[model samples]
Target: MPRRGIRSWFTVRVTTALFTIPLWLDLTAVAVGAIQGAMFAARLTERRIDLLGVALIGVIVGLGGGILRDLLLNQRPAAISDNWYLPVATAAALLGMLLLRVFTKLNGLIIALDAVTIGLFGAIGTSKALAYGVPEVPAVFVGVISAVGGSILRDVALNLPIALMHVGSLYAIAATAGTVLLVVLVSLGVNVVVAAGLCVVVTTLTRLGSVRYGWSLPEQRALGSWRVWRRA
Candidate 1:
């Protein structure tokens, strides 16, 4: 029974990874990521970022995942070198600006897409990291970073508070969990697609559950040496 369960989870992860992406899917994710970047920019920068900022954010969202992957792998950034990642991100950001207000108002839509983004990138991150011979634990970290780095960049650029820093339903936690889960399943000899599918389902459910139930990790305790700090 335990073996079957592992197999099932692994199958789930891989299917989620492979099947969800269509030949035409790049355009959608790039667009969505770009827009997410732009909206983050609009609120982040103390003063508005000009066209350059928008374009940069777009690129960040579109290619950010892949770039982080390469950097972790100790290779040159593919995001900067390869394909249409730049243009796609820029276009998405521009489009995002148009719809951001409306999108923000609709919590459900944002939540749904955000969940998708987390799943896609988190799994990709895990896959790429492992390819570079990253250990399982670090691979999971890489995956989480890829999943959230772009948005984090956008928020920092906009001068808005970092999303991860604030109180919200599990955001990075979901991505990290998915990546780690996939890695564990693969180590156990489960099929790749199944692993990815399980990752996505786990990620989506975790995020939705967090939002639905206000789930959060406990606050960190102070250091072992509890010294009362002197006021300045």
Candidate 2:
């Protein structure tokens, strides 16, 4: 009876851990973001982002989103406060820097990587916010911000135009759709892992599909610019 009871307890603990697996998504997201950041730095020779710059960008990409999300959630930013977060990010950054040269020529791969990171972060963010009992709308917003925050930081550091502000891609829209879907499903009592998987799939597909099909939001042309053009 004692041995049977111990086995049952062990099974219960393992089952609990399995259910919490979604919490680890952030780590994978950070790794992918770091790799993308390194690639971005490699591409910006004209901007003079060398090896150290690459590492800096990688670190920012890896942790920027989580920091922002934590701040918004009124929690300690794990990226800054957690020992493991820094070490993991730093190691990933160094690895990205070391691998920078080889991936420079893999055109379109960066876009794919960006899409993947967005999906991972978006799903993870929504799951976390929901777990914290955040209100539904705010949870969705958190997911969107987490999805785009790192890239915004990366662009700002590089002195590049913010990708989210542009009309060229369905970045925010994709995140919104996925996050909303996840929230809705969870509300309907879907399994968390299944919901998260679906969210990631929708986000990634929407982003990559928009890119492939040249689908973009309509640009809002400035009336003043149009008037000036007419005068000319």
Candidate 3:
């Protein structure tokens, strides 16, 4: 019975570890995030993420979105030019495995945290853009896109329908919602921390509600009965 129980707990740990993993190492937080992301993909189907594959995905997840965000803002590529990023990703990968061992049931917890990450992703992009004097509307969109881009890449690599595309929570919608919220709040003269907190709250609630009640936006389909009849 104990052996069986251990196996069951092990399964849960593996999933959570595979699921909520993040980039934690200070050396290069972004790189760690990328490595953790690819490890996430590799673990979903029980296939080992070899050094090359994991490294590639790690870099992709860690720096790809930021690169795009920076380019859009006309800044230098931080991950490539900076020295600390790669080590950060490596440490984050190892830390994920350790965290998994500690929490046997973390899928839900990870998802919750992932929402916060999304919010941070959006807010960071927006604030940075604004600091650089980018216009409000463009800054907001850039923020929202950067927030969702990492997950999009992670999903595509895993061969799963992007969660943002499926019926269920408004993933992109949440990001968009947060981005707009930030823009409006800032325009109204709210402090950045306060504005960011509100953005995170909205984004988190949007995601949590989707998880809790399976909420999603309306689907598009052609209506066969709605053909227009011309009255001559």
Candidate 4:
């Protein structure tokens, strides 16, 4: 065999070994995402969303990230390819609907779950991108998209302003920080599972802290005012 062929083969194997996540964990992330989506839809009582509408929103939020990630990677979407994802998402969405009042009262729990969901998706996306030999920066981009793709789609489907565009919590920023950390740790030969765990922790903490303290990126107007003040 040619030396180049051997090197490529070795890289593929190592990357695959390092980045693949267990199926159960991935599904858990999907379930949480679905629940969040349903809850968001439920909150819009004024929208007059029907039961079908709620389920659809849940499925979109649950599966949107993975679908987007797969499309970008030019692969079949795992959510569709696997039999379990759709049913799980649908059921979880219904569950969310059933427990809406309870969840609303426990808003902190929802926020915590949201943070963990973001981390899980981000880690999964980054790992898959790395396994596919995507460049580090691009992998981080993919991860962030995977983390927030569902919410983006939900807002678009409902014709609402995209939360990502608005100055809200550190949603994308937290995802980016986690993904970047994963890439850095992996490059340093850290254990893949450990790095992923750390990614989740960092992402979750950043998200929770932002929520707790109302941290947000400066809006365009704020930035403009700062610049004018500097000029003065």
Question: Total clashing residue pairs per candidate?
Answer: 21, 0, 7, 0
Q: Determine which window of 10 residues in candidate 1 has minimal summed lDDT.
A: 223-232
Q: Which pairs clash inside model 3?
A: 28-85, 28-88, 31-89, 32-89, 34-58, 34-62, 35-58
Query: Model 2 Cα displacement at 213 (Å)?
Result: 1.3
What C-alpha RMSD separates each model from the true structure?
6.3, 8.6, 15.0, 3.7
Worst 10 residues of 2 by lDDT: 1-10
Lowest-sum lDDT 10-residue window in model 4: 1-10
Q: What is the model-wide C-alpha lDDT for candidate 3?
A: 0.64
Deviation in Å, model 4, residue 194 alpha carbon = 1.5
Q: Give per-residue lDDT, candidate 1, residue 37.
A: 71
lDDT (10s digit) by residue, model 2, range 133-201: 576789899999899888889899988899889988798999999999987876665666788789999
lDDT of 2: 0.78
lDDT of 3 by residue, 1-232 (tens): 4334423433444344322323342233363355456556545546665655655555566665667788888888556776767666655555554454443366676667667767767766776666566667887878876777766776677566876776665878888888788767766656555676788788878878888888877554423334432331
**Candidate 1 residue-wise lDDT, 41-99, digit = tens:** 66555675787776777777667766766687788875566566666777777777767
TM-score of 2: 0.81
Model 3, runs deviating above 4 Å:
1-36, 46-49, 97-104, 156-161, 222-232
Score each candidate by Cα lDDT. 0.72, 0.78, 0.64, 0.87
Tens digit of per-residue lDDT, candidate 4, span 1-232: 3334423543765556653567888888999999989999988999999999999999999999999999999889998788999999999999899899998899888889989999999988987787777877888999999999999999999999999888876999999999999888877667667888999999999999899999898777876566656865
| Per-residue lDDT value at 194 in model 4 | 81
TM-scores, one per candidate:
0.77, 0.81, 0.72, 0.90
Candidate 2: which pairs clash? none
